[model samples]
Target: MTTILKPLALAATMTLAFAAPALAQDAQPQAPSQAPAEDKTPVTPEAWAVHLQVTDILQHYPAFHSAFQGPNSFRPQATTGNTVDATLYAGVKPWAGGEIWGNLEMYQGYAPNNTLGAAGYVNGDGAKVGRSHPYARIARLFIRQTFDLGGEADDQEADLNALGRRRTKDRVVLTAGKLNATDVFDTNKYAHDPRQDFLNWSLITAGSFDYAADAWGYTYGAAAEWYRGDWAWRAGVFDLSIVPNNAVLTSDFSQFQVIGEAERRFTLGGRPGAVRLAGFVTRGGMGRYDDATALALATGKPADAALVRHYRSRPGAYLNVEQEVADGVGLFGRLGWADGTYEAYEYTDIDRTAQAGVSVSGERWGRKGDTVAAAVVVNDLSSAGERYLNAGGLGILIGDGRLPHPGAERILETYYSLGFAKGMTFSLDNQLIQNPAYNRDRGPVDVVSLRLHLER
Candidate 1:
């Protein structure tokens, strides 16, 4: 994996101190309406809402980390890795109907793995060096147009006077071109920030499997949303749009591909605060780890490896509610679950795993942006009885050595953020991961990380 970052993307990351914000643009899809609204919001100029936004984040992650097994330990290795990331965001939406968004992200002396601290960032000669950090990680550009297609969250029937936001009533809403959606758990993600969410001490970018995190590194895509209220829906087809290098402006998706998702939102909550529930399914370009491995063995390189771009599918559901639980605190939670293989590689390391979790977010101690929360996630796959842990080289095998422990693997987290001056933020986390099938009584791995986030 290349560890160098682009400097242009980095410069862009630093100059957004006074930008404006237009955060409400990302909205959820709703079902059809049952009643004709006595009052309606039209698409006419008089009813259009214009919003603009600018948001940037800079995060530093410096840690003293170690991994060591006894003499019999699979792998006893220790090292320290420190990385600096800067992300930039800017967008404008002249009206509710259309908008444009862009981003740039850069990294500094980025290194891979948690070395015991020998190399901050090693060069070709394996010598640790400074002053070579760069300007561009990657850049992304996109535009989208939305049309009210069908229904409102409260209506189960059709209403002609109502404007559709998702898949509504006869009207077809389409979003064409390139784009990326901010839908992950970490708010500071999308770009590079040490404070952003982590998976096993690695940036969720670990999901990058290989791709680097970018400010606007997201490529473009086109989608269509059709609705009339009750049965209308939304779906889109898009490309990774990622290129080889932005300097040449290469539009090659050599690794480029397509993806899509469909969903239905319904009301099942009857309690006063109950709002709506959504069940969604997705299908598209997905890769596989084993396949990539095989391709590597066959072709001798990743770029040459034939990706298992199967028409993979994933289905999940989510529910959101808001209510006050105490004098100064309000409680809101979202519960979601999804089942599917993200790529062909997923099937080998994991079959059909259940991805489910819940988050509790509420206001904190009489302060703003100052909030506290807790969350737990469970991901489990029915192993065909295969478990293998190849740490230092020796393999610990159990069953067929193909599956995770017989239960769900989990990650639990809690945090408090004082969204205050100089953008001060602090969080501490303890992560425990265990799988009997894989590790076979090794131990429940525990990791603790502290983050201090700042933004100007």
Candidate 2:
């Protein structure tokens, strides 16, 4: 990974050096009278905007014990791994109420356990990219058109995926092309961004939803949203990968998924809050746990999901809620359920899950720009799923040698972010895992991580 990061660092430095001179040439001191009347208003005309972000995460784990291990079990040896992901976001307003955007991203590295064991996997970003050297891909390429209704307008802030613009309180937005489902559904303000918030997979999104995507979690999809006052409705359709957890997506539309979500915003005790209800249904070729287990029993061999593969529909649902509890403190929770009869196609091996957590800003401690967050997640599989695991069936990321005493996988994650310089921040994260991969015999494990992030 160092081989890849060196050139990227040099590129970043050269970009800054060139940008400084151009910015200096474009700068002009304005007189008091020449200044805009409203300091908060958007001064730049609707045009092109750019965003860049880079993150590096290093994770380490101490050795732990297990009665037995399988082909895909997490290693019980002290190990350390690192990952880096950098993205360039570019957007342009082509016409009234329309904007086109694209993101070119580079990713490298892998998790110490090859991203296995706990249902709420410890490293979200690392889990997305497989074990490999740095490689570039088009993460997002989409166009958005917003139609305004007769209502007051609000100023939109320029952020990672958005450009500074004004839109009416009531509007309709249509987006099409390749992107991520989470960017439009089941969003929680306190725990969605792995780059800045919770680093666990389950904390960022519904662990059981199993949205359609390739190895890196991006898919071809289109979404439509209607926003009115304090309510919003969203729906989308995306293509599924050719096979479960495969690296390549299907070219045809035979395998796909449909997702829908509804959101409501309100104020509780003068504090803002939001609730989102989301669900998804996928049509694809998948295996049934019961069938696989039965086949293994009849043949006196290890369970093989491939032998029971069939085309079917699987559905899942989850509810997300977040609220600002105080000046710099917030709370969030999620409850999710999925069709446990079928093997997990994407995401983790979770049939039922529940998680909740809190995030606090450093203002309380006089740091002002730092944050602290913690969450607890519990995940379980269905009886058939458990039986298949006991029969030595391997799912996407987890399966121990055996499960004589099956138990729910429980995880606790906490992190603290310290901002010591402009455009840079460092975070210390820790995770505790119990009953990893549903094997009670395997003991609890401890994993720690350090992350550094820069944005411009």
For model 1, the stretches where C-alpha displacement exceeds 4 angstroms are 1-80, 93-96, 109-132, 148-178, 181-217, 225-232, 240-364, 382-408, 436-438, 441-443, 454-456
lDDT for each residue of candidate 1 in 1-456, tens digit (9 for 90 to 100): 011123223322321111111112112344778988886544333222222212222222333222323222212133233444454655555566565555455545423231111100111111112123545533445555555543453321211112222323445555544444322111121111225322221222111111211223344455565555433344543333222112122144333333233333333222222223444343344443344445555664422112444544544444443333232333333343444223212111222222222222223223545544433334333222121112111111122212222344444433344455545665554344343223333333333444555543
Residues 160-223 of candidate 2 have per-residue lDDT tens digits of 7787788878999999988888888888898988888888888889788798888888899899
RMSD in order of candidates: 13.3, 10.2
- Top candidate when judged by lDDT against the true structure: 2
Question: Relative to the unseen true structure, what is the C-alpha lDDT of residue 305 in candidate 2, on a scale of 0 to 100?
Answer: 91
Candidate 2 local lDDT, residue 33: 89
- The positional error of residue 402 in candidate 1, measured at the CA in angstroms, is 9.2
Per-residue error for 337 in candidate 2, Å, reads: 0.4
Q: TM-score of the candidate numbered 1? A: 0.50
